[model samples]
Target chain A: MNSVFWTHLVKDLRIEWRSLDAIVSMLFFAGLVVVLFSLAFDPRAAVSQGIAGGVLCVATMFASVSALNQAWSREIRHQVMDAQRMTPSSGAQLYFAKVLVNFIFVTLVQIALAPFFFVMYNLHIAGPAWVLALILPLGTWALVCNGVFFAALSIRSRNRELLLSLILFPIFIPALLGMVQATTAVLTGDNDPWLWIKMLTGYDIIFTTVSLLLFDVVFHAE
Target chain B: MKKAAFTLFPLITILLMVWGYYQAIYVAPDDALQGYVFRIIYYHVPSASVAFCFFAVSLLGSIGYLAFRRSDPNKAQIADAWALAGAEVGVIFCTVVLTTGPLWGRRAWGIWWTWDARLTTTLVLWLIYMSYLLLRRFAAGPQMQTLAAVLGIFGALDVPIVYMSNRWWRTQHPAPVFGGGEGSGMKDPTMVHALLWNMLAWFCWGMLVLLLRYKVERRHQEYAELEAEEALASAD
Candidate 1:
């Protein structure tokens, strides 16, 4: 299982490395969103400071969706998913690998966008930087876990992109709320970042477990 | 017998609705706080409850569909019909809630909407089910049912989180009027009775809608089966 998982993960990583399709496009989109946000809001205003965290999270969410779509579309396009299913590796293994790859892709895009977000929004992290360090990965993992699952689920649809976004966004509300709140706490030096982080972690665990258990059903349903 | 039962449903529903409305308007005393505007509660609360109930039913149907899909395709077909019916009815009731909520909000809260947890969650719930319906419409082949069932289960899971998030994060939405801990009940017995009657009436109406919608879905499935059979026969 472990070997199968790593092999799948490496396969996805190599594909992305060779094409640079998912990562580059996601980063570019993320950057554009940040720039658009800066243009829309006066960075010097108090409202901008308040909304910076939310805007950054929203941009990341949109970019992650694109990356997820790219990841799954590549599989569907090349018939790689069909090939993977023929392997002895369980659907769970492939799910986890895809989730990990997506998590990494989204997180890298987020990291690339972070500097631009800070510079464009004129944002400063007032809290301990460790708070962000903890929240970023956990938050991204939660988002990608759902993303990868929904991306796969919607892959068979006629309007895959629209269906994926429509289904994914609403289910993502709780996590989005938690991440935005936690990020806000870190940015504004709010006293209770831990509460939001706890919520995000809880959400991450619940969704990851649920999606893993259900992935096989969805994978073979067709 | 089934035809007779179907014929009886509308009569009962109409009677209950008329009685419930009378009780709401004439029997229930004016709310000391919001007065006439609070009457919308009788409609809005019951619609929301029915919506929630239908979604719950849809969840069960989805579970049944998924559980029996492989072993008993017939049972799965019935389950899928139930799920389709429940979701369609649920969405209709949800639309009522969404509409009535804003009207009440505008009159009582002096705003069209607030990002309060319940309102936001309700909106998300509507979107979730709307997505479910869209998926059913657009997704192809035998896998569509299973895929939709999975989404139905996930959407059901979200309701609790949505409710909890609202409870934990206080917003402009008033705290729960029922089951909310501490100081959340009607003072007037007549008002409570009116609310109860309306809730019962709405439940009956919702069930009737579900039954009718289920028949429609069953027939639609049968029609599709016939078409497929005919196509195969002609090809042969």
Candidate 2:
């Protein structure tokens, strides 16, 4: 079971490593968003501090959509998903592997964006750096878990990219709010970062479990 | 008997709506704070409530469809019909709530919109279900129903979380205007009656619309099944 998970993960990683399609596009998109936002607002102003967290989360969310779609669309386009269905390995394993891969990809894009954000926005992290670090993965995990699940669900659709975003963004509001609020607290020197962290953790756990259990239904629905 | 029940529903709805409107405008006293603009509450509050109720129905139908899908295809079809009906009707009422809300807000809050907890949550709820309907429309295939059912369940699950997060976050909109704690709610019995009457009327009208929509969905499903069968026959 564990081997199955690792094999799938490695396969995806290798494909991404060779093509650099999803990661490069996501980074470029995130960079553009940061630049556009910087152009719109003077980073030296008070408003920048208030808007920074939201802008970062929004950029990540939009960029991750393309990455998530690519992750599933490649399998569907190549009939790889059908082949996997014939294998003895559980669908949940494949789901977990894809989710882990997506999480990593999103995290890397975010990491690449972080320095740009700091430079462009003239941002300062007032809270412990550890809080931002911890929040990054937890928040990204929550986003990508839902992203991958919905990507699979919408993979066979004609208008999947639009459909996936339409379905995902609304459901993503709570987690996005949590991440934005927590990041806001961290940047603005607010003391209650834990509240947002707890919310993010809870969001991640509930969504991951639900997505894992229901993935088989999505996979076998045809 | 079924036909009679169907015919009777529209009549009852019309009468209730007429009475409810009269009670709201003439019988119920104007609110001390907002005066006449508060009458919009009669429609706005009930529409929002009915919208939430329809979503609840959609959730139940989605669960039922998924649960019975393998064991009984017929039951699954019924569940799918109900889910479709609930979502369509829910979106309609949600539209009314969203529209009426801003109009009320324009007069009361002096702004057309606010990031108030209730308003934001309602907006999110509307988006989630609208996506559900859109998925059903465009994502054509045998798996569409199953996929839509999963989405329906997930959307419903997100509603409470959306509400909670918005509440914890700051809100610009007013707090619960009705059924809230002390200092909230109406004092006059007639106003209470008008509110309840409008709620009941809207619920009945919503159900009437839901039943009609369910019939349309049933017919659409039947047509699709027939087309598939004809295609298979021609291929053979």
Candidate 3:
């Protein structure tokens, strides 16, 4: 509804749309994660059903980091942050825009990698598959929301790319647990996936709210 | 007076630590079940308690830093110093928990480690703070304290989630945990006394370290500020 958010979202989308840099690189990186994992774990094993969920989440985590690390690169390169500060709009809008654009790119990459997962792992969802539609996006939001915020937090760090993973992964651990366990539940029909899905949804809400509230503090900091 | 305290506090901490050790090793009755190995609780549990308490201190410091940064910049710096001191000391105690727990476990539980809920949560807490420490180390700028404070809050927020999730995961295939339920066996009064004594000693030691660290950080902060002011003057 706000023009600032839309303007930011549209600008980011147009930039990625024109260049396709983040998407292509992410797809390649995620695809590599899938292929390497398929080789190392041998999806033909009896345990493939159990592990496929973790593999998918791990792939998304790595791929999102690849994009998130540079999500602020475009702004930093041309003194865009200074201009952003001069604007009357709040920093949270800019944060949400970057998160959304990155989320879309990662989701596209996941969609592209879906066929590979299905073919490689022979994944057959035994439980409600539609919950996965709920699960994947929630898990991605958990990663991307924190990922984007931490990316901003570490934007001034010396080894930002490395620092980003270090800070992001540990905080991301709980969500990673929820995502993998929920997926495993859905795929195997062993446990109630609803419990884990709720956990993930709660985590997303809590951290996203924190990020939005703190974005101004981070954005305006000297 | 400050110099006297600086020297006397550490000396007192050392004496208390010695007294605690004597109470733990010589006075406390050894468990009939665990034998001499049961003594590790005096060290292990207290360290964990201190670790957890200091992390809370860090969280308070972080919040204080953020809340005071704009309105009270000087107070914010003090808070930032405490935040760093708390994390560093908490991490050291957590390290004791992780290491000595394994030693106690090897002798008592017959296994070194397990994927149990308490242990996993402790390990994850360690990691989250370790990452926080790393961010403080790697980050270089004016906003480093603000960023680290935000991360500290994030890390603290995750601890409960990690604990609950690990419990759920452990439920699927429950592994052995130290102590049957909440914590290990502390049914005896003498054992509780020993544990209480050691907790006091460790807390004393931890406080001495924490205050010493806070003072050092405050000094460093002042020096850095002075340098910045001088640089500004020279540039002008």
Question: Could you report the Cα RMSD, in angstroms, for every candidate shown?
Answer: 1.5, 1.5, 2.4
State the lDDT of candidate 2 residue by residue for B65-111, as single tens digits. Answer: 99999999888888999998999899999999999999988998899
Ranking by DockQ: 2, 1, 3
Pairs that collide, model 1 = none
> What TM-score does each of the candidates earn?
0.97, 0.97, 0.95
lDDT tens digits, residues A22-141, model 1? 999999988888888778875685677689989888988988888888867887766888887788767999999999988888888888888877777777777887888888888889
- Candidate 2's displacement at residue B221, Å, is 1.5
Residue pairs clashing, model 3: B179-B184
Better of 1 and 3 by DockQ: 1
Q: Write the per-residue lDDT of candidate 2 for residues A1-222, one digit (tens) a residue.
A: 589999999999999999999999999999998888788875675777778998999999999999998988889766888999889878999999999998899999998888878878877777776788888788899899999999999888879888889989999999999999998888887667898899889889999999999999998888
lDDT of 1 by residue, B1-236 (tens): 98898889899999999999999999999888888989988999999999988998899999999999999998998999999898999999999999999998898899998878889889989989999999999897679999999999999888778767765666777666577767777878898999999999999999998998998989988898899999999999
DockQ of predicted model 2:
0.86
Note the chain A TM-score of all models in turn.
0.96, 0.97, 0.97
After superposing candidate 2, which stretches have Cα over 4 Å from the reference? B172-179
Q: Comparing candidate 1 with candidate 3, which one achieves the higher TM-score? A: 1
